[model samples]
Target: MAPGARRLATEVVLPVPESGDPVVVELGAGAGVFTGLIQELLGGRGHHLAVEADPRLASSLAARHPRARILNDDASALPQLLAEYGLGAADVVISGLPWAGPDRATQRTTLDCVRRVLAPQGAFTAFGYAHATRLTSARRFRRMLGSSFEEVIPGRTVWGSMPPAFVYHARRPRPRKSAETIDLLAAQLASRAAAATDMRF
Candidate 1:
């Protein structure tokens, strides 16, 4: 809701790699506060795609960070969007979205999408307000985060933020198996089923 402090932005983008051409994605990139910082950190190396559902905000963010790909679409569609863009998976995902506001289903689905789109070694980051952690949605989000990834680390509270928030740096998401693995397994199962049917015939 609030434009995050620069310090907060710094903490949020900590997972971004300094080396190589990383596929970085950002969700809920409101007003491009974190977007600009990410772009600066990237230094024009990686493909940065920022998803902002709000058309106006997406447009503004696109204008501000022309180098970054700003999409006017829901964050839940991240996997499909990556496929459409011909990218394999995200190396790092930084979210500025408010987890406390979204319902339980929304939270689960979005995080699942992120996990599916993440590379095996990818990292994900999202923030929560300290004062709001006791709320139902916020508490549920924390639990959801824990369940979503193999490792979820809550960073120190950013006193500079308007309401004092901490970032959750998650790694090694538990997205079942890679898409290639799933496809291969499906093909193998179908082959086995066909062989059994032929034998019965």
Candidate 2:
């Protein structure tokens, strides 16, 4: 990661809850670059999960950051992995994953997991190198984000980094009712209507 890019990624607004500590999940935590900064941000008050798909890098991350739990798994399984640790949602998700990839499908899958695990008002920050912005994968990723998030904000370019990069800040829309919840509500309404008809008869 470029120096400027690292700063941009760490500068993301972490919306901590009013009561307890915030939950942070870092994806593609390669070489522990942004790992330390995130730990400092959390200040040991909340949980930080560093996920790296490579076993060797995951082991290194564990050794370097004892305060964080290293998950040696794919980023796409973030929801399930968080559940194993008894964490339902994350307040902020900092991703260093290569959004402009060999193909867009894998990146989409990983992003879907990021959205799934984030709290309704949570923020997701990711960086893309300036040079790669013109790539087809990058363009597609940006468009996908626009459709996925309620608000998608772009940060200033970090020219200090080797190859300048910019940050993409995204927030999900307000939480929507679950399918089961809607079904239950419909059932209750139907029962109430039947009761009213029977009373009239």
C-alpha lDDT of all candidate models, in order: 0.86, 0.78
Candidate 2, residues 12-72, lDDT tens digits: the string is 4344333468898999988887888887666777898989999999999999889999999
Score residue 28 of candidate 2 by CA lDDT.
91
Structural RMSD, model 1: 11.0
Candidate 2, residue 10: lDDT: 58
Off by over 4 Å in 1: 1-4, 177-201
Candidate 2 local distance difference test against the native: 0.78
| Count of steric clashes across candidates, in order | 0, 0
Best by TM-score: 1
lDDT of 1 by residue, 54-147 (tens): 9999998888888999999999899999999999999999998999998867887887898889998889999889999888788667766666
Candidate 2 ranges with C-alpha deviation above 4 Å:
1-6, 12-19, 173-201
Best by lDDT: 1
TM-score attained by model 1 = 0.84
Question: TM per model?
Answer: 0.84, 0.80
